[model samples]
Target chain A: MKILVCLGNVPDTTTKIRFDGEMKNLATEGVQWVINPWDELALTRALEIKEGSGGKIEKVSVVNVGKADAEPTIRKALAIGADDAYRIDADPSDAYFIAAQIAEVVKNNNFEIIFAGKESSDFNGSAVGSMLAEFLDIPSVSAVSAFDFPDGKVVLKRDIDGGKETIGIDTPFVTIVQKGISINPRIPAMRGIMMARTKPINVSQPVAVDTLVEYETFELPEAKAECKMVDPENTDALVDLLHNEAKVI
Target chain B: MDFELTEEQLMMKQAARDFAERELLPDVIERDAEARFPVRQVKMLAELGFFGISVDPQYGGSGMDALSYVLALEEIAKIDSATAVILAVHNSLVAYGIETYGNEDQKQKFLPELASGNKIGAFLLSEPEAGSDATSQKTTAEDKGDYYLLNGTKNWITSADNAGIYLVIAQTDPDKKHKGINAFIVDRHSEGISLGPHEEKMGMRSSDTHSVMFTDVKVPKENRIGEDGFGFKFAMKLLDGGRIGIAAQAIGIAGGAFDRAVQYSKERKAFGTEIANHQAVAFKLADMAVKLENGRNLVYKCATLKDQKKDFSTLSAMAKQYCADSAMEITTEAVQIHGGYGYVKEYHVERLMREAKVTQIYEGTSEIQKIVISRSLLKD
Candidate 1:
């Protein structure tokens, strides 16, 4: 059995975001790219499963819907213990577009289980995993935290309304994993990093997919104003200010 | 020519950053306060193959280039200088020395354990009498045909309490003086070995530092590195590489402090705006930044020279000298920028500043480095 994790190439969390001249796209001048955090966790869980499978699980591959600039991020997945990698050479347009693109390649492969992070860290669009499932006409379980494969039987602990609900699922399904899937994402060892150099990232031309959403213009969030600390004896002034400035009193 | 890190090097840098931020940063203050060794973190580093970052894979090492080691060491030092020094002594001094000079039996016996982190390694050269003047050796390793009976007291040894293997330098024949020096790989658990209590240090307190005492310790002939009288030259060569690690560590310490200061300045309000808006603080930041960059470039050049199998001894001395001095300066200014907050332990700049002091004094003093560079210059 093979597992496929959907990888996303996103900027490092510490990057100071800046927009391009058009105000519709991020400036890529000094961005350090990395694998999306949640996606990395998903990959880690998959690798752990493969390591413990004892020949039951053959390979854990990764597929990324990104452009050439995302190669390093994709290779990071390979270094993190993904058996093989594929990059659909296209700018990740949107959640639906990315889902549709990934489905096309996955349909041709022998991937029994597919995993995707609930959302990419760059754009918190909690839609890709389900969209991919719909695109492939397969069932998917969302909000999964724990996954176990015992004696060829798949089990999952999914987050419910107030607690976790244990679930038993079969193969040929998509799993949208959230936190608690793994404690920490695996850091690539020196051996893995060395081997990653020759591990090929099989790049293929992306099939035509329609974008559902387009940004008109990008704007920075408003800078928060300093809070005015009110003295204990100034309740009346505070009330007056609240009534006039906040207009919520 | 170019300043681009390879894929492996970038991964190493990122892994080091993650490990430092996740494992070392949280309890670093508490560790510093308690003067505790980072036992758990050291194990994690060993598991990550950092202990053998530059050793050959055949000997169970990571077979990485010098740049990768520096990138990782810099990150580690940025978070915990104590832990970084432990790694420095192991990789650059002990493991590197053994791999470069050891025979097949020594490599097969010692390298695997050292690389695996199962057995920690320490370099014992500095005695109570000899500090900067390494030629003066009072310890004796009396030749006894099959083995040498060692008797010495090595002071200021990092990881002395935790190390399982010792790279001991001692005088084999007093008649030959410095030329009679020999290096041996002595098992630290030997019957005659003892250690002094851990030192109460001003900075880098988390690493276990103790003076090692050896009384009639037996080391077989196979454990000696190279031919007789090769010990001094071996120690000198290994010190060159060790300087590279320390230089990176110094830069990292400075960088760590500088980072905290920059963040604090931007948030710290003075008259009506952030302290960063003040020209005095801003100029200090500029100077610190330039020094850090210059030091980093010099260190990287040395690492690159080493990777290319070129002679890096003189430049490494310069790197160690410049980086250690600037680290002391930058850390002091970082604390100054943090004002009252920096004086405390939780703010971390205080700890970084304190930790930066030893970089100038250890491995080779700044004055010793100047002597090396001057000699190379005169010769050139």
Candidate 2:
């Protein structure tokens, strides 16, 4: 069995940001890069399955859609235990374009399963996995909390509003993972890092896909007002303030 | 030029840090004071793959590299140095030596158990008479046909009482000084082997350190490591790698001290302002930060060099020396930064200060490292 994991390269959680006047993108100086936290669960679950299933997995591949600069993140995934890798040489403009590129790759690979994060930390759109599944014409289950592979089928419990739903699916499918899927991803040792350097990472320019959406401008949310305390002695003043000034009681 | 860590390395680092914080930190002070070795903690380490960080996966080990080993050790040391030392000797000195030099049959028998943490391992190198000059070992191993009769005294051995296996170094040929030395694997259950009472220690008291008496003990010839008479060279080679573990320990001590100082400096007030506002306190902190960053860089470089199988003897020694001294210096300064509180056991710095002193003394002394460095340069 072969598994493909999709990873998102994003700014570290503690990164300090600033905008250069011209480039319109956030400045990159002093920024740390990390694998999206949710994606870690996907990769870790894949590794666990490979181990628990008695090395039944023939290959573990990671596909990333980004510019050439994203190679390090791809390399990081490889070191984390992916057997082989692919990089679609394009800056993902939105979820649809990213999904289409991944689907293009999936059409030829015949991978038994595809795993991805439920949402990218930066975008929080939670759309790529479902979009990729739709484009590939395969079934997809999102926000999976647990998974098991038994006799060529996957059993899973997916998260829902205030509850969960258990489902089972056969091979050639996609799963969008959420947090708490597995223990935090294991770090590649120094030796694993060295070996990852030698592994092959195939890079190709992704064929452009037409899109209906485009960014107009980025805007900031309205700032919050300072809190005011109610005076204990003046009940009538507090009532008037709540009814008029604050417009709430 | 490629300094970025692989994803797996990142994962291991996170796991070790999380484990150290969750499992080791809460018990450190109590264990150190009571001179207790938490057996459960050791077993937990094994369960989590700490024992087999550098061992091959085929032997039920983690099949991790030396860099991984040091990184995990550093994280554990940050919580408890005693636990870190036990792990270092077990992984670097004992397990690594056996895996590298032992025959295939020996590897199959010993590596699996050791790797799985089912059995603990110890290395016996120091004798009462030979420490800095380790080649002057007085222990002797006589050829008794199929078995070697080992008779010797080894002191200051970590995990001596509880370890199931010991990698002992003894002079096999009485006539040939250092060249006559040989290494052997001895089981603690052997008829003539017994452990001495635990030595009372100034620091790292939670680790069990004791002496061993080998009275006409018999070891199978197959247990010998590498070729006969190669023991002296092998011991040096093993220690060169072990120095990296020491460096990690040193980093841990310094890190513990640095963390306390950073927190206290931010919160403690003196003369109506945070003491951190004082230039005197601030300068001292700056120096500690500089030393710690430099020491970390040196140690990381050494670990990386080791993974490439490069000749990094000098770098390893330098990292050990610099980091150990830095730990001692930084911890002392950390105590000074705390003033009256630093002298009290209630503060963690006092304990960390005591622990920092040992890193300079063990593995290889700071003076011995200078010799290795000078010798390497002179030859070059």
Candidate 3:
């Protein structure tokens, strides 16, 4: 089965972010890039299926929609046991545009399954995979808790707001895996990293279509208010503060 | 340049960690307090294919890399150093010795049983007179045609009484000096072979230590490893690998102590805040983590190098010295972090502290390691 996993390269959470007031871009001084946590789970699951089935994986390709900056994350995705990778060279600005780019490449691939994270941490939109599925006109199970291919059928359990629903789809399907699915995706060992260096990475220039959604100047949230402490000795004042000011009573 | 571990190595790490947390940790303190030999834990280790981790699959053992063996040892030792030694001695010192230096017939004769964990093995090197100066050993093996009559007393032998086989190094020709020593494989059932009373140790009491005696014990000529006079060199070579195992063991102990310290510091309250809020306690933890991570990286590098047949003597010595020292510091700090509770036997950190002290002394002392480093530098 041909499995395509969408991996994103983003600054790790511990990365220090600096914004230049002069230019409208975040400074990339000492940034470390890692595979998106959700994408990691999806890749690991795909690798598991590839190993367990004893069937030849046509390609464990990582499909990314970003510029050359995203290649390292693609490389790391390869390092984490993906067979190969595909990077669509276009800075992903909007969810729909990115989805359209993915659908363009995947339309002719005849891929059995396309796996992706439920949401990218940087955007937190949780819309890309669903949009990609819509663009490709394939059944997609988003926010999947578990995925299993038992008896030649793809089985997926997706968590909704209230409960989980188990859905079995045919061979060709799309799954947007959520975080905390499998054991935290393993850091590719030194050997896997070295081996990844020699593996094939297909890079293509896919210009994203113009979109309505555009980024304006980014702004920070308002500062928090100062905390007020109640005097324990003054019962009347504490009661008055609780009822009128703090509103706890 | 290939620095990655195989899938088997990854599995070994998980297995050792799982075994340590589930089987070893629960009774580790009680075992240490009572100076108990964790026979059950030893059996469990054997069941997990730990006793012969580096042995070939053809020999009924897990055909794992040297790094995998060390990684597993580090995890096990983190929970219980005593149980870890049982694994180290059996695999590194004894089984590894035979596998590397023994003839094809010898390998077929003994390795399968030892590798299968069906029979335990121990290496006898340190005599009462010999500790670090192993050449000073007084044990003798006189050739008697078909068999050699062995007479020696090996002190501080781990798994001495229970081991089915003992790989003994003895003076075959006293006049030839260090060259006179020869390696012999002696079965425990051999006549006049007896185990002295188990010694009461400060820590790692859960691993059995005793003096093994050889009085007119006859081992066949076929049992001798390699040629005569090659024993000391073989022993030292075996020890190079053994040092890596001890390094891993040290990392495990340090990792365990540090984990407990971190957990306690986060929970224990003092002066209206958790002890972790205090920079003194917090810095201690941070230092411990730093030392552990660095030491672990070195040990793993050394182990991986050894597996790849790369030049690893310097790395092994560095790892052994750094990890052993780190373990001592970390476990000591772990006790201090526990404050009053750490002084008592009820807390495991106290036991860990005692266990950490020996790692620096054995498998070549930290001082000896410095000497090795200096010697290598001089040669270079």
Candidate 4:
């Protein structure tokens, strides 16, 4: 079985985010890019599934819909044990466009399974996996927190409103994985990094798709107010502040 | 002239950092307090190919450069010096010594297991009387044609109980003194070999340190690292490389302490504002950062020199001395920044301070390093 993982790059969670002068784009200066955390979990789970398959799963490939600048992030996935990578040379304008690019590869490759993060941390669009499934005309499972492969079928567990729900699907499926699928994402060892340098990363031209969304402006979240310390001795005062000034009891 | 780490090196550093934070940091304080060896974590590191960071790929190693090894070591040491020292000894001292000096047969026999960490390795050079002056002869290896009868006691040996193989330095000829010393690869499970109870330490408590005794244990002739008289030179050469590892460890410890102090300064309030806003606390952070940068530069320079196979003894000694001193001073200041909380174990700085002290004392003491540096300069 051949598996494909869709990788996305985002600023590290701890990076100090800033907006450009026009407030329409992220300030990239000094920003450290990482494999989107959710996508990393997805890639990790795919590798884990391959390992557990006992020779049934033959290959794991990662694809990214971005420019050459994103190759490092793609290489990171390769270092984490992906067999190879596909770079779709295009600006990742929107989920639909990105999904279309992936679908083009899937049509040619005939991959049995495709995995993607439930949402990219940058845009939080939560749209690509399902859209890719729709474009490819295959089953798509979202918010997959756990999975297993038994007798070549996909058994996935996902979180519902109050609990989890399990579903079994046939081959040729798309899964948008989240946390809890894998205990932790594997860090690429030094050996892996060395090998990744020589690993095949096939770059291909993007299959053009009409984008339906456009960014208007970017805004930073409002800064939080300084904390107000409450005196333990004045219970009434604390209660009054909570009820009136803070307006919470 | 390029100072930036290569992409591969950065990835290796990130991998080590991630592993250290996730696997080693969780129970580190508790482990230190309980003096428990992090066996599971060590195995994890081995699985990640850390045991053979600089070993050749054919020898089951990652085949990385020395700078990469230093980067990884620094990241690991930043979180837990105990675990870092274990890795350092295995990679820098034991496996490196064997790969550099051992014959092809010895390399084939030991490098694979050592690199894979199936058999952990330790360097046994220091003794009760042979700490600073490593040439003092007490351990003896009686040449017996087919094998040698080894008898000695090694003190303050790292990973003593856990190591499966030991690179033991012993005297083959009592009359030759330092020239008489021979390096031997002795299996820890050899007959007549015994271990003393673990030593309770001030810092790096989780790292197992013990006394190893060899009472007439027979070591195969093939296990001798080099020629009979080559032991002293072998030990010295390996120690020069070992200094780079220790220096990296020192930088890591100092970096860790500085990071914590910076975080604390930001969160701590004094005079109705964050302590970081105050000049006194801010200047301390500045000083710590400058020292850390200098120490890191020295460490990497030594590592690069070693990787290039140049004569780096003086540089290694200088790097080790400066970095270790920086670690001690920085950690002490970190505790001071934390105030009373730093004095206690809950805050973690006190433990870092304790762990930093040994770096100044072990491998080669700061005083010994100075001697090496001065001697080199004078000779020039």
Q: List the residue pairs that clash in candidate 2.
A: A186-B11, A187-B8, A187-B9, A187-B10, A187-B11, A187-B12, A188-B8, A188-B9
Tens digits of per-residue lDDT, candidate 3, B104-136, equal 999988998898677888889998899888888
Winning model by TM-score: 4
For candidate 2, the TM-score is 0.79
For residues B153-245, write the lDDT of model 2, one tens digit per residue. Answer: 999999998798899999999788899999998888899998899888989989999999999999999999888899999999999999999
Q: Over the stretch A71-190, how does candidate 2's per-residue lDDT look in tens digits?
A: 777787876788888889998889999999999878778787999899988778899999999998899988898888776567898989999888988878899988668866765543
lDDT of each: 0.92, 0.86, 0.82, 0.92
The C-alpha stretches of model 2 lying farther than 4 A from their native spots are: A53-60, A137-139, A150-153, A169-173, A189-200, A211-249, B1-72, B95-120, B128-140, B171-181, B197-202, B225-237, B263-275, B297-319, B335-351, B367-380
Chain A superposition TM-score per model: 0.92, 0.87, 0.87, 0.95
True contacts kept of each: 0.58, 0.10, 0.00, 0.77
Better of 2 and 3 by TM-score: 2
Clashing pairs in 1: none
lDDT score at residue A200, model 2, on the 0-100 scale: 86
The digit string of per-residue lDDT tens for model 3 on A106-213 reads 886778799879888776788888988888888888889888877557878888889889888886667889855677574453334445667887787885476779
Clashing pairs in 3: A191-B4, B78-B252
Candidate 1, residues B194-282: lDDT per residue as tens digits?
A: 99999999999999899999999999988899999999899999999999999999999999999999999999999988999999999
Question: What digit string (tens of lDDT, one per residue) describes model 4 on residues B1-380?
Answer: 98989888989999999999999999999999999999999888889899998999999999999999999999999999999999999999999999999999999999999999898999899888888899895999999999999988999999999999999999999898899999999898999999899999999999999999999999999999878789999999999999999999999999998999999999999899999999988898899999999999999999898888898999999999999999999999999999999999888899999999999999999999999999998994
Per-prediction TM-score, please? 0.97, 0.79, 0.67, 0.98
